[model samples]
Target: MCYNATTSATAFTISVLCSIYLIYSGNKTHNNVDIFAGIATFMIGLMQLLEYVLWKNQDCNWINKYASMSIPVVLYLQIIVFHIANKYLYNATSPTYDNVYIIMNILFAIYVICLLVWLSDQKLCSKPSANSCRLVWAPFEKLLNYKYGSYNVGWVLLLLGFLFYIQFGIPLNGLFYLQRSFSVHKHNYPIRNIFPYITIIAALVYTIVTDGKRMSDTFGSMWCFLCVSYGIVSIMHI
Candidate 1:
């Protein structure tokens, strides 16, 4: 579980750094793009790490699986946006976006490969524990064809995540301003009220919609769990 272990440790580290910056930035780095990426980077990084290592051992380390597959899409999008909009936010290179993109892309590719191996085998849920890394080539003589359908129960879940992602940051700006506000007689520091119910819903939909043996199944399901769980955990800690 090197990936899993690394991801968890990395998430904690990034979260700590972001937390410090948020708490003690003293209005200095308030508009930093790197700062904005603090939570996004940590959440995806840690989640992917878990997915890579855990999947090597178990067919489904349900939580890690979601993180590994789904969060990259966000990371990819965030990096692109932050790089383009650095000044409005901050300088371009605070959080090592280059390394994040390169490393995440590689990790994403590996996890996909692992999923391919799993899909080729029929005995997905039932198996003995040790050293079960299957080959890239299919175990069965006939190759299994995987499909991603537009119409399904899974659409409901995707919709839920879409909504949460859009709404979660409404009061987040004020969260960074909390310390200064605390000294005042009355204050309304920004706050975000969010519950990641969509993440779970998405996972269920992915499960119902996709073929269990396909790599898409592994990634799609895991993505939902990681996104929501990471958000919930981060907010609670905050």
Candidate 2:
């Protein structure tokens, strides 16, 4: 296993708790964003638990399948969280609804469709092997001990998501517009930007560092530590 079962299990438990709270809060406030965040958190928690179980069973092939499937979900959810947070923070109501957001949703859906098609083409999802899905990005390809991997398109999606996030927070005129618009909203801009970025960065760093080295256990331990810390902060926020 790339990570410890106990650590993953603990993180999973924390995630489940955080998700429950988010769902309750979302329902109470009628906030769709909070509900999405709750769902994302639950998915991540479930993935971690599933990974733990597969690891316990010594099923590397299934681990590969799970990671391949889950990473995109995580990345997409990160985008959603950031975009929603950006909308709330800036209060930038576009003249008509947010066409950009709609476009992004459509694009993301298309991208997922393409990804599934690619997965089918490679037969990675149907096949069973430890490294069959290994067609990833430049560094991640190396990190996962494969020359290539199945998530080449995922890297593109993640980049697009991040770009959209920055754009949402600071539109074409950029941070200057953001500052000017804040005057109208009057709500203190809580550092809501930090969470999604931190989560993405931590997940990326953990993936790269843990998989790129022979002594992955050491890095995996730190990854678990970071996940725990993030979970604690998330609960406090909820």
Candidate 3:
């Protein structure tokens, strides 16, 4: 997802280091949440490594196809795992919240299915910047242009769906924390308590700004980088 292989590799290395730290700290403090977060971070790093391979290959070969496919699948698995860990940590047993969670997962499943279908017809091509390659489907771009006047709409919608899919858990977790905070008589808001909301807000702002200013082709790569980097940094607050 990075602009180049070096950037992707660097991100992977940083993620690995952060993952190790999180796991070690979790074990020392006996916090299973941190341990789960560490696993998620490691998965993000693995995705970055796959991205690095894609960047290096930049071809229509099986290696590029599988690497590109793995990124989304890994991301989907990581988010599901993280959601389960968070629910377990919070003991989220409310029927209403559980129903909402199920609905969100169903929507995310649909998005992933569409995304995989879209990717199946895409081919790797160099970006206008020539600094990196991206997956492009000429027919999709033409269809968007014909229907909407702008080719960016499809990418924007896809990105929005992805954002909603990954971030839906944040508010659910936040609601639980807010209720617990009110009942616990806590005077100060700890970083751990507000980190999820902060992450959601930050992600929204970053994606909006980047998409507005950059080419549509960069949206997926840039967002993947941001999410993984945020995942690494957010471990400290856990």
* C-alpha lDDT score of every prediction, in listed order: 0.37, 0.48, 0.58
Estimate the overall C-alpha local distance difference test score of candidate 1. 0.37
Residue 61 error, candidate 1, Å: 6.0
lDDT of 2: 0.48
In candidate 2, what are the lDDT values of residues 1-238, reduced to their tens digit?
1244576687888778877886788678765345545654665465466546544544336455555555445545555654565465455566444675677667775765565454433422212123422122212222233224555454455456446544542211124334444455433223432454554455557667767443233323433444444444544543
Best candidate (score: TM-score): 3
For model 2, what is the alpha-carbon lDDT of residue 108?
Answer: 72
Per-residue lDDT over 1-238 for candidate 3, one digit per residue giving the tens place of the 0 to 100 score: 5656787788888877877887788779876556655666676577667767777776557676666566556666765765676656545466886687778778877876786787676663322233335533232243233325644476566556557544653332335534643344322235644554565566567657776443434544644564356555556463
Worst 10 residues of 1 by lDDT: 134-143
Worst 10 residues of 3 by lDDT: 135-144
How many clashes would you count in candidate 2?
6
Task: Give per-model TM-scores.
Answer: 0.28, 0.51, 0.67
Q: Give the Å error, residue 1, model 3.
A: 4.2
On the 0 to 100 scale, the lDDT of residue 49 in model 1 is: 43
The better candidate by lDDT, 2 or 3, is 3
Clashes of 1: 11
Residue lDDT tens for model 1, 85-121: 3323432233553465456545544544554454434
